[model samples]
Target: MVEGAWLWLTLFAIGSTTILTRGSFVLGGEGARLPPALQRALRYAPAAALSALIMPDLLLDAGAFDPANPKLVAGIVVALAAVRSRNPWLPFFAGMGVLLVLRKGLGW
Candidate 1:
């Protein structure tokens, strides 16, 4: 019961932070304008965050990295496609396709 209490509190904290971080602008109304440089930098935050989340999975594992990890290779392929195509959602499918092909053909 005591251990579970901390887990519940942690979940609550995470949920609260997620809501607040995402909805802060909505809550603040239309009067705010961040400085241009800050806004430009902040625009990249999501991509930076996503890369941060992906890097460990791409680059590391329990023992070490496996360059043959299909996910990482697929991610690179998707990233390059996204760069070339400049379409937001297409890379997702490309990456998925890469992973599926690698998994099926190479058994990775």
Candidate 2:
């Protein structure tokens, strides 16, 4: 675990880097455009980030994929809910509800 001055220094460095990187566009003033390559790459950032965050939970169970995993079923429910309803919170609630039902009620 991080401790003492090292932790403070690490936190300060992270905060400084985040502010500088994210705020660069605003600080560069209006009408400033990113390079074409970066603009193209930025378009896929959300999908890539989301997959990076969620793919592991959907695919992994005790270090291996398990067909019987409740998370997999809940993820499917969430995916279908996401496609069927455009409302942002619907998929989250649906996924959680399905998970609860499967894990608690059905004992999946």
Candidate 3:
């Protein structure tokens, strides 16, 4: 509603939401400990979010789904690396390397 720039407004909204979300856990006491079933679901949250973020890029082909794609292959490789190792940089480099090889070296 203000006459300020869009970027500042966006940043403010993000920062405010972050504070509120973080504060929920910080303020909660022993009552906040999640139940077993809920904790099981929470365990998969990261994978679910990652899939939501990555699936479109891997599955989309010129705005449509294409089952056979290099990006999909590389993404799977990266996911495997992440699942196997605690080190963060390895998966990143693995994904980046696969993309480079597919796009530059193999021309596919």
Cα distance off (Å), candidate 2, residue 58: 0.9
Q: What is the per-residue lDDT of model 3 for residues 46-75, given as tens digits with 9 covering 90 to 100?
A: 899988988899999899999688898898
* TM match of model 2 to true structure: 0.72
Displacement of residue 45 (Cα, Å) in model 3 is 5.1
Deviation from truth (RMSD, Å), model 1: 4.7
- TM-scores for the candidates: 0.58, 0.72, 0.68
Off by over 4 Å in 3: 1-4, 25-47
Question: Where does candidate 2 have its weakest 10-residue lDDT segment?
Answer: 59-68
Name the weakest run of 10 consecutive residues (lDDT summed) in model 1.
Answer: 59-68
Compose the digit string of candidate 1's lDDT tens values, residues 61-93. 565977657778987998799789977888988
Report clashes for each candidate as comma-separated counts.
0, 0, 0
Which digits, one per residue and each the tens of the lDDT, describe model 2 over residues 20-41? 9789988889798889999899
Candidate 1: list runs displaced more than 4 Å.
1-11, 19-48
